[model samples]
Structure formats: C-alpha cells, structure tokens
Target: MKASALWPMIIILTLIITACSNNDEASEEVDEEDLEETTEITAFMPEHDEMNFEENSFTKLMEDEYNIDFEFETTSWDGTAANERRQISLASGDYPDVYYLIPWVDQFSPSDLIRYGKQGVLLPLNDLIEEHAPNLQAVLDEDEEFRAMATAPDGNIYGVPQLVECFHCTWGNKMWLNTSWLDELDLETPETHEEFKETLMAFRDEDPNGNGEQDEIPLSGSTMTQKESIIPFLMNGFIYDDLETRLLIEDGKVDFAANKEEWRDGLEYIRSLYDEGLIDPGAFTQNADAYMQLGNEEPNILGAAPAVHIQLFTDNDNQYDFDALAPLEGPNAAYSSYTHPIEQGATFALTNKASSAAQIKSIQVLDYMFTEEGSLRAFFGEEGEGWKKPEEGDVAINEDVEPIYVDIPEGEDETLRNDNWAASAQYYHPVEFRDGIVQVEDIYTEEGFERRLQEATYLYEDQEPEDVFPYWGVWYGEDVQDEIAELETNILDNVDQSAVRFITGDLSLEDDWDDYIAGLESLGVERYVEINQDAYDKYLENVE
Candidate 1:
C-alpha cells in the first residue's frame, strides 16, 4: 500500500472520533435541559389524616411517569371549614391550578359547577376531553346517564365526576332488624306490614331486650340524612317514597309524594305506631351521633333501625347482630326506596388559574384515574402489597376477567392504606368493573367489608318501582335554578317539620293533613314540579 493512502485513512479515523465526542457532549446537554423542563401543577383538595401527600405512591408514580409535580393547597377533612376555605380561595382569586374534591365532603354542587363555569372561574372540559382524555371520554360515551349528570344545562362539562356505581347504594333505605332479638323472642321475620307492626308491638310491650324493664324501642332511626330516615322504609310499604326528591313520576308527570293519598295513609300508619309508643321520638329529631349513641347503649334496646347499610350506622362489634329485613308487603304498595346508581358529584375541576400546560397535564392525570389499572390502584392501592390476585378457591363477583384482585392484609385498614390522592381521583367503579373484582363471604371483619354489603343489599334488589322519578340526574337551567332551589328547600323543610309533628302527636293527621298539603302548595311546588319536569324532559332528549 502507498504511504499517501495510509495517511488518508488515519486522518479519517481521527475526524470520526472527534465528531463522536462532540455528539456525546451535545446529547448530555439536551438530557440536562430535559431534566430541568418538568412542569409543576398546583392543586387544592381536602387532606386526609392518613395521607402523607409528599410520600404518596400515586403521586410518585405520576411525577415519574409524566414529568409533572403536583403541589397541593389542602384543607382538613372538616366539611364546613374546608368549604369555607374553598369559597374564600375562590373569592380572593388565590385558588390553585386544579380542585380535586371529595364529592361527599366538599365538592361543587351541580349548580355551583354551572355558576362557576359561566363566570369563567372554572374551565370547560369539552376541548380537553376531546384532545387528552380518551379514557374519560370513553366512560361518558358509554354511560349516557353519567354524561347527562356531569354536563351543565348550557351543554358543557364543567367538572369531572366520581362515578362510583355502588350497587348497594341504589336501594339504600333497607331496615336492619335485630334478628338476635327475634331469635331470642321466638318471633319470625315479618313478611307483611301488619306482621311488622305486630312484631314492633311485641318488641315494645314484651320487653325483648331481656332488661326486665320496658326500655326496648320497637323501631328507631335518625333524621341526619334521608338515607337514615325510617319514614322511607315504613312509608315505602304504602307508596313509593322517593326519599330525597319527594317526587315520583307517573304517566310522564311529576307529582309530590308527600301530598298524595297514599302518603296520608303511610303517615297515618306511622302515627299509630307513635301513638302506641312503638316508634322512637328521637328517630324524628335526632342527628347521627345521638342515634348511634342510642344503638350503642347497654342492653341493646333498639329493636330495628333504618340505614343505607348497617356499616353506616355502626362500626362497633354489635354491627354483626343485625340482619336486613326484606321490603314488607303493604295493601296498596310494596317498594323500596331507589336512588340513581350513578354518582354525579364533581370530584375533579380545573380552575382558570391553570396554565395551558397545567390544564393538559391535570386532565391527563384525571384521565389516568378512569383506566382499569388506575381505578384499582387509586381505590385499593399498589397490587401485591395492598391487594393480591385471587387464589383458585377465592370467589369473585364476576368469573370472566383475568387476575381478579382481592384485598391483602394491609388493605384491611381501608381508611389508612391508600393515599390521599385516591380520594380525589375521577373514576367510576361501574357494575361491570365491580363485578369482576374478587369478594369474600366474611362480613364480620374489615377484610371482607364489601362482601357483607353486597349480601345485605341483595334483599333490597329488584324491589324498586319501575316508574321511580329520575330526579338525581336532572339539571335545572340557570333561569329556574334559584326559584327551584328556594322552593325545594322550603317544601322539604316544611315536610320534614310537619312529618315530625304528625308522628309525635303535635299535629293531628286527620285534621292537619290538608293544611300540610296546602302549605306545600304555597311553597310554589307546582312551579317546582314544572321546572323539574322540564329539566327531566331535556335530560331525556339529551340522553335518550
């Protein structure tokens, strides 16, 4: 080979090595810039005591996977204080980039969603749903009921909702009889309303509590929420009592259930129990704490109590003694109080303070929550540590899906195991999703909590009337919202007050019934119905 050729090859090798070194340095510089470019999102949410937000596994996952850090402006779980703080933030224009709310605690009401959305304080999610949230969009598309509830009257989705379709929550007015009392007294479970009345009489007069004194109250409940109210369960035997709405749909028209002839009969029956000292006086006026105290009292003086679930009423060891009574048959009607399965409460809302990048990432974060893996992780926590795949002998609600998971030992502390962000995540555990999960048969311990509820609620299934007024998903327009709200508040307050009076003998059912009806009429109930019916018609148009 020639000397010139060798020299050329050596020069080319040197040039190649130099070029490779420069390329490596450039790549290192780009990596440094990439590391520095992460976006931080600010969020406001109610903080749980068990949650260490900085150390939250879900937050860590999000930061690592998405190159985003969430800085939360939080309030304690106190409902009134949290709400006041949230409102003050809004008024002061110092709110965070996003609001992650617990629907049952301090989330935006549908009316508030509409109001804030229209005022430009809350951003419309239509564009974000179209661009970044395929998971959330899929949910809304598949479930029109959910879509209808989440959407505002002006046809914008102002907030993303917590879509928990807890099957047991659908018929939440079930009465749990102290079957231990029945077993001790040698009484059979009542099948008819009359039989139920006789059993209550026995509980009152016969001293079923074994205390040797007449301390047992035949029936008791609390007025904390309609779910705790006993009237729905007892009155339901006579007429369909839509517990919250107090309205029922028949022949495409909405009518007040409290003023109907069947309602009068139901009230009369409850009055008879009150007159005979069968019903607890505290049941009408007491709060949950007071009611719980009565139930937890020594000697087990309560014969029966109404609640959405026995767990809602008590977590004491005595919760095991109560067994759910099936819907009793009445002469005119036999139905259980039915609530809409879809939870429409807003759990995630984007504020106008969010930057465009923040907006995109916030929606992305929530969209992740709607996925199957995300839902399970947010709800139950990391698999294996918090939950585990079912064994061969384990029973799942649905047998088709693979790798159905059950709660592990750590997941038993349901109140403490999961992170705080899980409570604020937007996700819906629909029937299909919940059905595919594993459920154990044990109800006594915290390990198989869901199993106990599923079994107890089974008795109330298929007992709902076919024509239940779908008031839950209906949205009144801005024009009629105030009028409807004012009217509803007045009417519901009066109805509750009057019911207590009639049940406690402060008012006569036969004489004061017409006046009670007249008072409700005076509260602009006719206009209220008209507004709700219109909203219902509109919702049907959109959903159907």
Candidate 2:
C-alpha cells in the first residue's frame, strides 16, 4: 500500500478512537446513585388562570420526590366549561391517568364516580391506599366517618374525597348586620322575628347611610350562594331548614320542609318583607357580582346582608362594619341551619388507563400531600419563602395544637405564591391542626384573614339544632340514585320558583299554596321523601 492509503486509514482510526474516548467519558459522568428513572404521568386538573402548574412548588416537589414527570391538562379555576371537556375526554376514551379537581369547580359527583367506577373507567383505590398510600390509610383509620363517605355501597372507594373540616363552613347561612347603622339608630341586634322586622322597617324608614337620602337597602340578600340567600336563615327560624337536603329528618323520618305549614308561614313572613321593600328586589335574581356591588360600593348602601362570611360580598374596609346576626326567633321556631363538615364527591381519582406503576406514583404523591409538612406546603407554599415558622410568644388561634407557621407576605396573589395546589390535592387540616397555627396579628392584613373569619364564625358556631340532618355524608344507593336526582331537580326547581313567586307576589300565597303542595305531590314528593328516608336510615346504620 502507498503512503497516501496508509494516511487515510490512520486518519479514520484516530477519529474512531477519539469518538470512543468521548463516549466513555460521557457515560462515566452519570452517577448511578443519583440517576432517577422517572415515570411520566398525565393529569387533568382544575386551576385558576393565574396558576402555572409547571412552576408550582407543590408540583415540583412531588415530581422530584417521587421521580415522576407530570404532563398537566389544566382547566379554568371556575370550571365553567371544564365539565363538558371532562365528559368529552371520558367519551373519547382519551382520559388522562389522573384527575385533580376542586369540588366547587369541575369534579366527579358521587353518582358519576359510582357509574364510571362500575364501568371500570375509574380504578378503585382501596387496595392501592393500603399497599402504597399509608398517609391516606392513616387518615381513614383515624376518621371512620371519612371512610364511610369515601366507600361506595359496593364496598369500594372509587375516588378520593377531600376531607376539609372547615368549622365555619358547616353553618354557612348566618346573617350580618351593619352595627354602625344600628348604633346610629339606637337599635340593638334583633333577636325575635317581630323585633327583626321592626329593625328592618326602621332601616328602610331612617336614612341610616347619613346621605340624607333613602339610599339604604335596609335588608338585602342575593340568590348567588345559599349563604347569601336570606330565605335559608329566615326560614330556618320557622322550620328545620337543612339548606342542602331541603328536607329535614324529624322523629327519625325524612320530611319535606318546603311543603309544610311552617315553611308557608316563613314564606308569608318573607313576603311581608318583600311587600314593604325590605329585601332587595334584585336579591331574588341577582348574581354574586351584583350582590357584592350592594355592599362594596362607596357610601355603604346596604343596611343588612345575609352571608356565610362578610367576605363573600365585601372585603377590606367594607367588611369591618358588619357583624354576624343571631338566628331570629320566628312564629314556628328559631334555629340556625347546620351542615355536616365534609366535602362530598370525588376531588381526586385515577383513571383506568394509568399503568400499575403510574398508579403507585400517583398515590405516593397524594399521600405526601396529606402529611403535615406536605399539607402546609401544598396549601400555604414553602415555609421560608411562602411562609415562616412561628417564633416563641406567637399566639395561636387554639393553644392545644402547637403553632406551626405564620404567613410572610400574607395575602400575596396566588400567581406569586407557592401554594398553587390550593384545593387540587388532599389537604387534611382538622380543627386542632388549623387552630394551632399562628394567626395574623393584624386583622386588616392578609395574614389576619383566617383569624378574622375564625372570630366572626365563632359567634355562629354550635347554633345548630340537635337533629340537623347529616346530608353531607349521605349517598343515595344505585337503585334510587337516578330517581332521587330527577325528583330533586324537579322538586327544588318548583320550590325555588314558588318561593320567589310567593315573595314577589307573582302568585298569591294563600290561593296558590294548595296548588303548590299539590304540584309537589304530583312531582313525586312522597317517593322523594321515602327514597331519602331509606338512604338516611342506611346512612345511620352504616355510620353506627
């Protein structure tokens, strides 16, 4: 061979040697111990538009800890069109491996969960929780009521429900009176129906706003939320108005309150208020935005408003003037509406398409979120940047549980905070856990938000009657689920329309009362009662 041929061979050999050396060096750079084999999981979640899940601290922490990469499908926080999207995904059979939802937004109702679970579209979590999720299992072991609510009639937990034991949320339909107006008029908080009536009358008559004009609303409510509606609080003073079920359990039997004479008397009382222009005319149809405008606008046009929390309608300086009104004594009865404190329906679930490994990873991530450290991080954000550990002498809402941390910037925008998970994950903060946390010292600051709420809610707590219905935890069996749903839809619609008609004088309460009762009976109110009674009995039996 010539020297030129030898030169070409030598060049090729040197290039090959260099390539091999570089490859070996690259291989050596990877540390076996540090290498993580990540599993990719797809999830559909509900989120506020401001939240960026990719940059969320909770998501980052979970991904890092579990060695899993997440592909997220996030919908608007309000979830207005999210359900339609979810349904389409379900129908297309292109659903993600997991769903992380906020119940108030788009989430699986118990009926939906049961149906999808039975169809094998959702995976049962009982065995998975036991095998892979010790934290969730521990929660179940500690709270039997939670386990009962989570379990289906078929004896399987198809989805994970959020156990938010919010103390203030249980009796969310209390009224708030502007004490400044009352004091200016030399009136005390009304305790009786007649006294309350007189007070509203005075508010309407007197120019309480000091504008020297009849701009004061006197008494107002919105149809926005049950808490904002005046009917639940006022009507409850007349009968056991379980706001959710709209049916009360009396003498261990289910009874429809809307058709009862007490309910009629309550309507008549409310009608009198409407007739005299005490309640806001727009309260019957206006949304939260309009209702909030009544309280939040300058010059303070509202005299009194019905709400679970004043924050629902007003915030900042506008909220300070209001205080919770005690349940009024009515002709028939006097009681505040009570609710059991468990958010029903499924907030998180694994789809059938998830592989066994993916399922394990999913459960592990959720379990971590349920932990004390993880719960705080998931909700408030990372300790130092998002919040700070409590120092000595810091006061807690309750002294029984040790103080955890106080918020730093306090009330920063969700977009700027690490607590992007919000209600998307399982965050269990029982009364003790919550009360033990350091509260904001300043009532006006963002850190003081929870404390202020706690103080205001304290006045309304324990006002529930002994026999308030536990509708929050009940699940209608599969046999009557569809029927119950249909009946409720029709009955509630009829009742709501009739209530408005009676109040606004669209229908004569005296003349239309019998027809209204008849209408309900025609709509199968009897069967509705029977079905619920059966469910209630079954619920009691199971819980007992």
For all predicted structures, in order, the TM-scores are: 0.89, 0.89
What is the clash count for each candidate, in the order shown?
A: 0, 0
lDDT of 1 by residue, 1-544 (tens): 9997786566445434433433332222223344345767898988787787778888888877767888978888898988999877765556677888887778888887887777667778988898889999998898888998888888899898788887778888889898888888899999988899999988888777787998888889988788889888889888888887788888888877888888888888888888888888888888878888888877788888999888666667667778899988987777888888665657788876676667777888888888878887776778876677778887765445543677655434455754426567637677777766677557666666676777778888878777777777888888887888899899988888888888888999878888988888888888878888898789888788
Question: Which pairs clash in model 1?
Answer: none
Full-model lDDT, candidate 1 = 0.79
Overall lDDT per candidate, in order of appearance: 0.79, 0.79
Cα RMSDs of all predictions?
14.9, 12.8
Q: Residue 310 CA error for candidate 2 (Å)?
A: 1.0
